[model samples]
Target: MTRYWPRFNRAGFEESVAPIDYLEWYIPRLEELRAHNLSFSGMQYNWNVLDLLGDTIADIAKPYMGDVDDPKEIIAAREGVNIENVLITNGATQGINIALLTAIAKIRNKSNGKITVAVESPTYAPIPQSALILADDVIRVNRYPPKDYGHWRINYEEWSAALKKSDILMITPISNPSGWFFHKDDLAWIIDQAKISNVTIIADEAYNDAYREIDDYCSIHSVAPNSISINSLTKVYAMGHIRFGWIVSDSETIAIARRIFMTFSGVMSSPAMRIGTKVLQQSSIVDEAIADYRSKNLPKLRSVFAKHGIVWNEPLSGVFGCFELPNGIHSELFADHYCKVNDLLVVPGTMFSDSMQNWVRVAWSIDPKSFELAVDALDRSLELALNQKQVNKSK
Candidate 1:
């Protein structure tokens, strides 16, 4: 057990927000603070503290089944794919790890135990960290910069150039933290180019299954045979506690993935799998209920954000949106102090990208009253941050 992962065992790991060490150090501290906290650093929308689903999945002892109504089957059918391609996993993070590790296994011998990965920058930190651990090189193709919602394109020239060289293309479509939607047409072109270059594709579509969309977006698996799609119930479904996710790919790809998976996770969680099945069975009711909650409260939150001059892109799909910290406060510094003083949290965008040091992600997934309370707390933190900037400036 020599810790077989792609994490760099070098110095200066604490500096960047996207590195693995930062997340490992930061998350547990957040939990400890939450004894008296009201954090917005969440992925889901509209959850009640009390049990809502009534104990329906408590009796699962066997492996889950059904190419229909089963959680894996439900996701497969909804996405219009086959059950054989669906992989029921513990969480989207696990799904990502499996996808990357399986792909790495194939390239290890040929590339001398390493491969090149091209990841969309400003992505969820885990994406590149995992890739960095598994690949020889992880080239970051910066996505569209923040505050500009009109054009959310990758630099085609940069992306295509990288696609030609990379052995794997890993991306978070309708990503976490930013909720930036990669246009389906652009995705198609990328997938096609990846195919020509013989690169395997993994679309981490965890949020797409959660949020509402303006322009319909499809996962790359639908258009490419070599592509894998990952998703979960943690976000839009308000099922974070359940910790269920899955991967979808063609039979050959999934076959290899299943082999790698057996070495780690022996079997999917029966109870969570059952609950996932339950969620999918009732998806229409559940999805609409959460969407309706957002429809009611998001406008109020937007008004508050505008009043404070906090600018953000309206999320096209997920519950999270990145906001520029007013008065040029570095996001990591603001996050630490914001928690100490406010008893609440906003994830620093630096955790996703160092380039996003001036921004923080805001979540509006809680009930309106709780959201209002978080906003009120933010009201105080915002004022102090602004005033502090002036005090330092005048000195």
Candidate 2:
């Protein structure tokens, strides 16, 4: 038998998926903990639905039962854009994937030599990971660690220079793992550079609404002609199970990306479409969900992170933040250590960026009671991690 590696930079994503989900395959050693609600690992805000709008489970149960309802109207209203500008996707990830593939197709058809995707470094892993998998070429621009929470901006000059060398820029508005969103002027600077370089900016705003209380985030779709915004119900709406998301942009990009989406599955599931549209039309439900999460969980998480000496930028608009763990502990190791010993599962920063190896992303979104329990367990876990480090050194 012959064997070949995938060549895509999916190894890190593959390795971390199972552990991050707290499944039994790799963490057989922590079977009991696996069953517990100790998750701080995932980015989704798990919340209770305030209403049951489903007419019947059977009606929307199968894909064929749901009518040909388009999410364009609802999304257009939500994003304040024209109906033709929105294309519904199965999820934000799929939206991102199709967008990338569309760009690849366009660039390849132009007979442009292999295109380069410039990803801001220390970003959501999948931005670069997916780019590398699709384009097989990526130019990374580094973002230095902020000494404190208030200063989370990256150098505009450095980022623009990297943008000049690429055909596509896959960036996150409110970063996953990090929770650090860009300032308004910095976002404008990026858009200006993209226009100058003729690079398509894929602005991922998955976590945009998480900080609505603090900063009213403006999507680049309103400001930049060359930018596309992909967002999902997975994060802020606390509706991850719906698998609903959409891309907002000009007609040309939507036409190409829509064709790519059709090639993938033709249409989204009936239940997903029905539920997704309903959710978007109803803003009160979404608002209440996030408000509940903030009121119930933020204070405890803030206390827990501070007490553990975990330094992180206060998330401007999301429930999770990339956290710098104290010295004498590594992300992958501490993530495992914290999970097994304290049932507090976290995703290590290595999953996001190579430079973030010592960091771990902790979510403020989780089952509120479980999140509280995880916070209670933090001190003991940090102490245990330190003690274990000492033992390893002695060996």
Candidate 3:
């Protein structure tokens, strides 16, 4: 008997599905820290926006029993895709999970070798972690460092090589830490490579909706028919409570994903789909608020970072970016110290990748005045941390 590498090995699942360390570190600081919550990577939810939904609380609650309208139809009409191509899920996380499950199922049948998944470094934790469980092997395709720090651009050679061996490439279209959207030519090149290799590109597009103004903005599934694009209201629309997201791909892929989804979740939440429909119709309100926040707060954020001698990627559209720490201080150490001493919150980049230990992710999605206070607090925290490091050296 020949020993071929097994697909979705039970022992592999045990080792691969560890806790998402970032969420573990972040949730405590997020709840306990009362002042200056810079860790808000999403637009701060505007409580009053619910009143503008054009539905009474009682009317919205009706869907808890079940929704009459098909969510796939709603999203298809909005995204200009066919109903067959859409699969509604609880959130972007579930969309990604379903996509991976589908990808592995599709690849394992065809491949003689172990299935490999390639993910970007400095990424949102779940992308790589989820990939680890579903694939036989997971490899990092660096998105930073080879390029200068803070600047994000994919190296074509590395990606092309990875695509040859990989069954799935999990990417964030607009990167989480750096907020860098792919260059048009680069994206096209990647699609071509995936097409040639028959590798699936599962794009986590949670932040893509934020930059509709950008001319190059189009869902990956639309361009690369075999690829999948997943999006949600969690980050860009400031509607995390709704738990609404969807996947766009070819009809066949969507069908496969739906089956996998049903195995895990018997049905989608009716209430979430109903509220999500209203929110989609009312998205302009959130977009306008985001624009207002950016206009009033971006300059202040830029000014404060410059004052503190901190350099950042300077995001093109979104309100967040990755910052390189001064004097090569460890980001995890500084983030913990910052929260404890100053009651502030910032995400340490170590959560994204071990290589990113010297970097931190910061967001200015709060109101202008509140953001101003947070940046000032950040400045003071930086000085104190630096001074403390110096004191330790003297001892």
RMSD of each: 4.6, 4.9, 5.1
Best by TM-score: 3
lDDT of 2 by residue, 1-395 (tens): 11111122445454333122212322453344543343342344433343545444456666643363567887788778888899888888887888888777777855366788888766655567678667746787766767876536778778877887789988877765577777777777788888998888888877765555565468878878877888888777766787888889888888988898898878778878767766776656657655676678788877766766666567655566666766547777776666556765666666566677787666656667766776676556777876677787899
Quantify all predictions' global Cα lDDT against the true fold: 0.71, 0.69, 0.78
Per-model tally of clashing residue pairs? 1, 4, 0
TM-score quality measure for candidate 1: 0.85
TM-score preference between candidates 1 and 3, better one: 3
Q: Report the Cα lDDT for residue 292, model 3.
A: 91
Sorted on TM-score, highest at the top, how do the candidates line up? 3, 1, 2
Q: Which portions of model 1 show Cα errors greater than 4 Å?
A: 1-19, 32-58, 61-69, 106-113
What is residue 368's positional error in candidate 2, in angstroms?
3.2
Q: Whole-model lDDT, candidate 2?
A: 0.69
On lDDT, the stronger of 1 and 3 is: 3
In terms of lDDT, the best-performing candidate is 3
Task: Rank candidates by lDDT, best first.
Answer: 3, 1, 2
Q: Write the per-residue lDDT of candidate 1 for residues 1-395, one digit (tens) a residue.
A: 11211232223454443346446636775776542233343434444323434554344655655522566667778889788888888888889999998888776777755588888877766787877665668877877753455436777899999988889998887865677777667777887789889888888887777644466667768877788888887766767677888899887778888888888988777667766666667667656655765786678767867777777578765466777877779876776686548766777776666667787777776666776777777677777788888899999
